[model samples]
Target: MTVAGWETRKNVPLVGHQVLLQYRKGTSGAFVTPKKVRTDRDGWATATVKATADGAYRYDFAGTSLTRATTGSADFVDVK
Candidate 1:
């Protein structure tokens, strides 16, 4: 599965934010350390992963107090 077109809250645009991708293996409730990436003007972000490390994954968009923005989360699959 591929995840695309993720965005931030519509109320606020141009808010500094970051996207984190985390995954676990085989129905496990555990999520590993996430990879961080910046977002675009459309609030869209992307995260790529291989099925080799397949599992339930969570997308976290957190605010940066330093940047004074909010955070959000989404879920998707990464086909290897």
Candidate 2:
């Protein structure tokens, strides 16, 4: 599975920042930390993982000196 998202604050793109990719199995399941990636010039980070189970995917950017934008777990996919 490929996950991608933008790290932005006030509509401004944050480049070269660290981003984390996470996944959660079936509903009510605990989330698992799978990978970390860096944002590109466009503040976009992407990660590809082989899906082993039906779950959700989301990316998060930890706050940095560059920006204070942080994201919580969001549902991007629901595999049935």
Report, for every candidate in turn, its global Cα lDDT versus the true structure.
0.56, 0.70
Candidate 1 structure quality by residue, lDDT tens digits, 1-80: 11232474334443335667777776656777467766666566677666675467666655454343333443544557
Candidate 1 TM-score, C-alpha based? 0.56
TM-score of each predicted structure versus truth = 0.56, 0.68
Q: What residue pairs are clashing in model 2? A: 1-49
Displacement of the residue 47 alpha carbon in candidate 2, Å: 0.9
Worst 10 residues of 1 by lDDT: 1-10
**CA shift of 24, model 2, Å:** 0.8
lDDT of 2 at 17: 76
Any runs in candidate 2 off by more than 4 Å, and if so which? 1-12, 76-80
As a whole number from 0 to 100, the lDDT of residue 5 in candidate 1 is: 28
